[model samples]
Target chain A: MIIPYLELAISFLRVSLSAYGGGIAAISLIRHEVVVIRGWLSVEEFIRVVTLAEMTPGPLIVNTATFIGFRLAGVPGSLVATTAVLSPALLLLTALMLAARRLESRGQFRVRIQDAVKPAVLALMLMAIISFGRNAVTNLSTALIAALALAVLLVSRRKVHPVLVVIAGGIAGLFLL
Target chain B: MFVVFFRTGLLTFGGGYSILPVLHYELVDSRRWLSEQNYTDIVSKATAIPGAVSVNTAFLCGRVLRGKKGSATAVLGMAIPSVTTMILIAAYLFEYVHHPGVQRFMKGAAAAVAAQITYGVWLYARSAVRSVWVVLATAPLFAGAFFLGLHPLLLVATALVVGGPFVYRKAKLKAATSSPESEYSELME
Candidate 1:
């Protein structure tokens, strides 16, 4: 049991470190690892975890970790998995902060790094959009709602808050879906 | 104040776009901590980082509002609700979310989320993809990832290695063009 718990922690650590475009991107990877590779969870179990993670709070990645941990090893496992997943990020953030002042002082290096990073980041976003979109948009009503939402967003120039859009969409979904 | 944002964070489903409107209302319209321009700037910066833009925005906003104490408060607020909820759900209804009705609703919500994501991509492209060169570069990059089944991280890594030199040269050119004389002139003005 302890060994299984340790494996779960390490597996979550790998997922955390590899997740590039944040939580949504991480979900696919987590699903693949836990459901497909490790056999720790089934596909249905994976989706349930994801749904719970989405409906809950904090980072989705952390929520997923907690859920997976609890599922495998109870309360203690949840704590271990969450800590393991966050540790890498905490350490990386600390290292970055320590070097931040020095890095900022070097304008050329800073600009170069930004230049390299920006496009890559954009690419990641594009990937996330495409992948998640395929999974999310399935039916006609949904497709239309998504189209309406997109139009509202584009035309409004982000004048509206995303929360309202989500609420409106939810309400629309309740009626339309 | 922190608790308010925390609750908002927990309530937010979907992603950054889903939460953006609420955040704008709370931070700008209601709280009046910063102007619209400031909020937009922070969002841009948050997008550049490798995390949830909402979480990053919360951290930045908190820090701006109250320094380290504010930052701590903000993160705690944002984290607590979701952490608690997920844990409870994990413990109890671990098997309950998969009902057909629930899945149907999630599917519907996901569609709305898809649109939101598209809007985000369009918005970011408008600001970031200025030149034909950028478009030319971005289009095929997206196509390769989407169609070729290429992993996104690998694509990002490849882009960094390949685009680094040209981007470096461009930065150097821009820096050279904006000389010390202009910098001093602007400073004096």
Candidate 2:
């Protein structure tokens, strides 16, 4: 158990470190590792975890890591996995603080790096939506609900609380689906 | 600062960008730990880092406020509530999340989630792909991800290595040619 937990720790550390452009972009890498490579989770289960991540309040990566770690082992697994994923950010934060003062003048280089990564990140996000949409949008009612929800979010610019949207979607699902 | 970030973590919903409002209110508006200008700078810098945006924001703010220890405290405080909630869910309600009823709820919620993610697509595109050349270059990558079964990890890694320097050169050229009007001017305002 400890050995497997350590492996999980290592995997999450690698994933979190390589997860450029933030959590949403990281979802693809996670799916690749846990689903494609490790075979720890199926596509459906992975999508479900993605949903859980979205609904939760914390970081998507952390929430998904916790769930996967728990499913793999237990409480101890969860603790180890959480620590592993978070270690990079802590290390990076320290390095960033140390280097930030010296590197402050090179702001353009930093901005451009972010700019170059944006399109790829956007592509990954689109893939996530399409893949999940294909799975979730099975019937007419579900499709309508999805389109309506997309419209609502579009018009509102996601200002409305997400929990309300989830609740509303659930009620609609209960009645219609 | 620890208490403030803990509250921010506990109260925030939807994660990432959702914490922005709460952090702004407490750090900028209420406590005056950061001025509006400083807060904006923190946000931009946080976004530039990898990992979670909200957590990075907390970490950067903490470092700015105190030091390395402050960063650790802020991250821990922000993480505690969410981690506890997640672990509790895993312990008590894991099975139920996969039950028929809850799965149905997730089905609907998943659709909503998909919608929200679509909005993210546009949001990032607006910020990143301002030129036609970028769109043309990026469209193929998007298509490859969608159609050709290209892995996003590979795609993003390649983008970072290849595009990083390309964009840097472009920015430098643009800066050299254009007046020094300030790239961060919009953010400052």
* Top candidate by lDDT: 2
> Model 2, stretches more than 4 Å misplaced?
A1-8, A17-60, A68-74, A89-111, A157-159, B1-78, B177-189
B17-129 in candidate 2: lDDT tens per residue? 54554576677656789876566556545554567767888887898788778888989898888888788887786566657776676667656655554554554455455
Q: What is the lDDT of residue A137 in candidate 2?
A: 81
Error of 2 at B154 (Å): 3.1
Candidate that scores best on TM-score: 1
TM-score for predicted model 2 compared with the true structure: 0.69
lDDT: worst 10-residue window of model 1 chain B: B44-53
Residue pairs of candidate 2 with colliding backbone atoms: none
DockQ of each candidate, alpha-carbon based: 0.48, 0.43
- lDDT by residue (B20-86, candidate 1, tens digit) is 5567667876678877655654554454454455666676677667866886677667666766777
Backbone collision tally, model 2: 0
